[model samples]
Target: MRFYIQQFIRTIMMAVFAVFFLRLHVTGELARYVNPKYDGMSQLAAVIFVFLTFIQFSRIWKSKKDNQAHCSKECSHHHGDDHSFLKKVISYVILIFPLLTGFSLPPQTLNSSLAENKGTLLSEGQSLDIVQESDDHQYFPAVENTDKNHNEKPLPNNNYLQEEAYQKKMKTLEDVHSIDMNEDIFSSYYEVIRASPRDFVGKNITLQGFIYREEGLHSNQLVISRFLITHCIADASVIGLLTEFEQASSYEKDTWMEIEGTLDVTTHNGAELPIIKAKRGRVIKEPSNPYIYPVLRKMTD
Candidate 1:
């Protein structure tokens, strides 16, 4: 009977987990914890949970006869053992805590608090080139072509010229720098700015993020950051741009805001870093899906 009861408890826990994912899916909140590319995996887990639940029910049905056969006072006394009762209580408590907390509290994306603890990337301007190397290769692959005949020497591919033209056009747009930050293009914009901060200097841009103030920052200096999650929240890291706003002290830590500004280079602790000179700022609600996902392909829109 105790074994069947334990199985039933486990079944309930599995169902709870299954429902948790379902809840996130239905409310479009799954993107907060994971990239949208992995949404199918969550659905698959829910299906597996349902299958396991059926197996648990089958086991419970089969155990009914054995439970009746061992229904004597001796078995009852063993089932009521203090140590066994304590173990069962512990097991249930452990299983129920996550489910209760998940349902009771609202789901939130990583914010300034987590950014402060994990450390922000805006200060690490020197490492931007290294971070962007792989991304550059991925986005701009080499163009190659071979001559069809032995008499003909290999000629440069016209595709290379076209790609060069495209890059030049992109650079011209970057120079204009009127950037609009949204879920689709956030990663791409971040990569560009980090890779070559000087190219974007004096360009007007508007973006939104939570406030993150690192140690030793001046009264006018604060970071506007968003968590970049590759897989899930466990591996989330903060990436942000520094802002120079005189009224920074008026906003509380972790407050969400939309900032419009011009990108410029500034020296902080002898390190040349990119900072936004704020022209306008306004408080805004946090986005439902706050984490910026890495772009796997070129963002055309």
Candidate 2:
């Protein structure tokens, strides 16, 4: 029974170490080992770690025989202080090396191999980029309402707001527009979280950000984007909300619009989807400096 309990404890510890190592590998925390830019010494450390994990597991099967050979019976030396201390030192070195290398990562220092697959980080200096890209981007172009009569006009609705868990702070049209027109969203590390089913699933939420169009979808449908900044603008990502108005056909792509709506769940192609059917939506003149939101892949990553 005592032997079984000891084996169980050892197995648990090994599992913990394995899980920790695997997570660091999967979430890209282990990029330094695979990076060509790392110095030779860094690469050597990685190879040593891989070798150590294998050797430690190898010792388990021969533990009794090894102990007997290393400690003579007449000497009565069990695997005593010196051996125990060495084991501890080896464990510490093995565990600490991987994490230490991970901590040395610089801002956006990830490999270029994965960079194209990742989202672009934006800053306040790139506000013009938002204007140009968003204005030029076409999600559903043919349906864009170019008719002067159909252009969006602002509607005042003091009672239109439906309370939510996450609320968008009411900023005056002037206050929102005046947020440093010269600065870009990337420089500000600004992010917009929306109250749409796509993000929060079923939760009611409010959103504040500039509108962007998706080409394959209906022409009037727009995606409201907000930057999700992690450490800096260079690492920013964009999050989106899908908005559809009953009179959606009346609006153009890239129109600056404010919308208050309920969360709606729907599907697109084969996957689940979210739709915000506006309770009230009105267009405002494109703000002098618009807030561009970043895209974060997963919240905890």
Candidate 3:
């Protein structure tokens, strides 16, 4: 009973923090402390937590003399009251394991886990490197070279030349916009980018919009977003393309740019790939909202 009371107090405190953590103004660090990812999985966890906490509270209440006295008349069994604390601990740990894992792992790490394999885990060290099937992003392990290595003679002073080239590349990219969206690339909403995942599975596509970051995903990829609303931007969820440009290094997240590229299909873990493709285009900064379209849950063309 005492253990249950202590658990109740801790759960209450966590619930309070979760409310504030999900608030719009909360910083990422604070939010992670309370709700971690705050994505669908985290939201589901909060719901389950609330449900289980109530069940525990009910059990704790039933342990009291007044509750037992009143409920005994209506019920025949209070078997859970006699359950050992070790059994309770084991049961709670099994039930709450998912929530603990969800809140503890970083969001991007979660993405990799979803995309790759269940056996994958964050490295013991602090490095951002992840274990993936390929080196699609910088944080993950390098991909194996698919091209066969011929026994060609090595270039003289290869290391020095590579260093010099890298330095020059860095100098060129110092002022480039991290994200670029160009409005002219796509004439109308439907005319350029196709919304159907079926039709565009293996084709090239382009999109332009303001940039935003997502948890459990790569940072450099542009989330070409458009606000869909039944009422307003508050309810305006984003539906757009997730792509890497052929010359994408110049653009920054949230910077506007018009992308011109081909469509490609990719599979992440078991989750459907979020319409990822390749493109070659110019990036240009502009106002956040360039097009005015009706906000619907799904885009139908």
Candidate 4:
């Protein structure tokens, strides 16, 4: 038993990893950690962990003769018993900490308070059209999203779109009289609006996001913001619109709301930016999945 104790502990470690990853998938929480487009790879990791557990378990009961079946006993490579007890304990503790926390703590839903650490949705001179998707945004051609002209779809896992669907949404943007800014098309259309704020002026638009405020906003104004994430939440960027209304002061920060009004242009630092003249709005519950993903238009339309 002493000879195999380290082998037993290693086998248990591998098994725990397999269980942790598989549980995230079973409970549909894997999206909380990474972009859904990469789910296939994550699931593969869980599967590989399971395979390793079986393979490592086989090593625990092997006799010295069978252990040498793969490599000669003369092999110089390190094995389970190679390290001192204290060294082994320290190394394994480091490996175990993240896994234990992953199971013991829930993935926090990124909200307004925590989002400030990421920075303001837009800088004083930042133009929405200049906000390009970073390298991580490149995935499955075009992402599936919602627009005013189309029905909303299930989010998080199914956010990436087939090429056909993406083109249709792009075309819809050009032809629609009103814009519905759902998670799927929010970032894309924001670029269009800022690129030519005049073109969208008087256009009635609707959107939903948590309330956020920053410097340069009036007391009657706030930013309706969402975190734009790719791969992981830690790297999320804030994206939203500057909106103003008399009732804005009545609502506190971090309040989630759905609002509709006309799109109007405002000047800051002599640059034209889009601002929502909110007509009517109501507080709403926080979304189940609040993060907005950046999309890639794989094919030219």
Local error of candidate 1 at residue 182 (angstroms): 2.4
Task: Give, for candidate 1, the lowest lDDT window spanning 10 residues.
Answer: 129-138
Instruction: State the lDDT of candidate 4 residue by residue for 208-242, as single tens digits.
Output: 88899876666767899887777787777777888
For model 1, the stretches where C-alpha displacement exceeds 4 angstroms are: 1-3, 63-94, 124-175, 298-301
Pick by lDDT: which candidate is best? 4
Candidate 2 positional error at 246, Å: 3.0
RMSD of 1: 14.3
Error at 4, model 2, angstroms: 81
TM-score winner between 1 and 3, please give it.
1
Per-residue lDDT of 8 in model 4? 78
Clashing pairs in 4: 144-161, 145-184
On a 0 to 1 TM-score scale, where does candidate 3 land against the true structure? 0.32
Off by over 4 Å in 4: 1-3, 64-81, 125-157, 298-301
Clashes of 4: 2
- lDDT per residue as tens, model 3, 248-278: 4444555554555444443345333434444
